[model samples]
Target: MADRMRKPAEETKADLDKLFLEKSRVKETMSDVLAKLTANRPKDALQFIADYFQSTFEQSKRLDKCYRCIMMTHHSRPVYQQNIASAFDILNQSKLGKGLYGVTGSIFDELITLILQGTPESHIKKMTDRLSRRRYEAVTYHVFHYAVTILAVYKDYLRVAEDLFELLDVNSSGQVDKVYADLLLTQLSTTFDHFKKDCHSGIQAGISLSPDALHTTVSKVSRNATGKEFIDCKHFLELSADVYLSLLQPPD
Candidate 1:
């Protein structure tokens, strides 16, 4: 039976067609999940199957999330910075075309309303005013650069912590599993190195995490979270940042 199946399988059976219709990867996600299940070798596969969807993974593939992510990722690049300057140029012209000059508070507010969040409106107004000299506008590539710099990097710990949470929460479930706690440590390390390389942050690369340190943090959070059996990203990052930031060092 195995020999016969091998002869016809190529023609009769098919692998998962790579799903790429308008960024919807439901088919691909299921394929990966099923592949992991086989590797996991759960004793009661049926019960595992029953708990699969119920346990986690509802996607938060929002359009705004995508746009924000793209903008954030590329903001440090020269060409992207140029494009932003050009966009500011266009917006400035649009204001002038309306018999106004410089990027206005109202215009700046409208442009950023969709992409920027967790920032105070008052702070935003002050930013616009600062760039516009307490009055009229938002460009020159330098002015745009300064303003974009703020937009890109000015958030405090609490506000930008959501980005860390979203980074760790692979399924956008707002939490991560205890089983993958070690995995998150790996991800955190890689993310640090990636950011250092990508943003030229001068953090010194090749950062590594001590597994015991991460495990202790995970255990502490799991205790505090109580019965959730999962560590929410907020608690994990907040606590781990304290423990691990000191530990991070350039490879000697």
Candidate 2:
């Protein structure tokens, strides 16, 4: 029976066509979600986003594709502006903000690596053209916030923080200097506060970092690096991925 029932060319073609259609449907659904996310009525968008994340199964497999779609859409002018504004507003305020917040660190890492790997200046210029100054800053803040929050809960936060300080130094300076040190502390503190407020309150207080402890760590790191020499981007990205994955770690 097996020998007599060999698969035909037509069957292979039909299977390929079906697979293509499935992928196309997924892309369209993602596009719709992206649109809703960046649109003016962010509350409705947030609900849809939360629902999508909740309903989706095997999220690990699709995460990269979803992240790429978001980045591509965010690079376009109209969608870029909308996302910048909505990201700041919705992501900074609502509980459903987790949907937007959870995915941005890796996306930011990807963007920074891609930019730095090439002519960074030209790529930065193009980014500036696509996004307004405020929006650009907001997006930057979100990325840092996401990265720091994830790292703070884990054992390697200091290492990753120091690496970031060096990368932003840009001058290949041995030390973190005052400005960048302050910037790192600020990002860490702000994101820590956010988690304390949003993630560690009411019924969801199962997983959180100690605000005072986080602040102390930030202060110590910042002060130690004030005059001390520091050592680094893809390495930081790998560290960022580690931190991001840690967020998904199940509570004991």
Candidate 3:
């Protein structure tokens, strides 16, 4: 992934100037469109805010894309401050937008940072109250930076995802085994289904299990069942795959 924080000071300065000019042009165009729309029927402030946000994102994507392409620039410092100010401006213009209770600067930071970190618009919508100017900025900034650190350390969210999957796989088999697998399937049917259908298909055929499953499986298989003893990692691996298969194709 391209580094968002690698831009030089000079490049950032140049980019900021260009971004500002483009934003001004877009604001003018949006004003004209809104004026025409409100000519006959009056729209509430929230509706207008929503419209402006949609249009702004559309028009601003060019600049946003450009910013994404380049490394973070010193020039961006001022622009970033300005953007925060603009976000507040939108919030102040709407009645319902401002009436949100418990809104804080941290929340605004959190919401905006999530947006910058590529969180889906739908997810952001689910957090509309927290995303307000007062709250998002306050809550998200530090957390978002931490999220960025995790991204940097792991290289990608999918890698973290892989780690989580492995943690549940137990037995080093490509899948969960019968007992543990059955429990997981019963407890998280939808998640289990989605995991197998989507997430498991591409994982390396190796298994790792959650803590309790590991202890139980080890205890059960070592119970002096004589010929049924599990001796090594290979045994564990086979057990895992067997568990996975049984869950996937249980007899009716």
Q: Of the candidates shown, which would achieve the greatest lDDT relative to the real structure?
A: 1
lDDT of every model, 2 decimals: 0.49, 0.44, 0.41
Q: What does candidate 1's lDDT look like per residue over 154-177, in tens digits?
A: 343234344545654658887866
Report, for all candidates in order, the number of backbone clashes.
Answer: 3, 0, 30
Write model 2 residue lDDT over 1-252, tens digit each, in one string.
Answer: 874676798678878998897744567568756875777456676687877656443333344343343345423245654544443343333122444433333234433333233333433343323322332133455444343233224323444455556655667754545544554555544554555457544223212234444445555566455444332333333333333343342222
Comparing 1 and 2 on TM-score, the stronger one: 1
TM-score of each: 0.35, 0.23, 0.24
CA lDDT for candidate 2: 0.44
Sort order, lDDT high to low: 1, 2, 3
- Candidate 2 lDDT at 231 equals 28
The better candidate by lDDT, 1 or 3, is: 1
Deviation in Å, model 1, residue 67 alpha carbon: 9.5
Which 10-residue span in candidate 3 carries the lowest summed lDDT? 148-157
Q: Which is the leading candidate under TM-score?
A: 1
Tens digits of per-residue lDDT for model 3 on 135-176?
223333343333223223222322333343455555665543
Q: Which 10 consecutive positions of candidate 1 have the poorest summed lDDT? A: 55-64
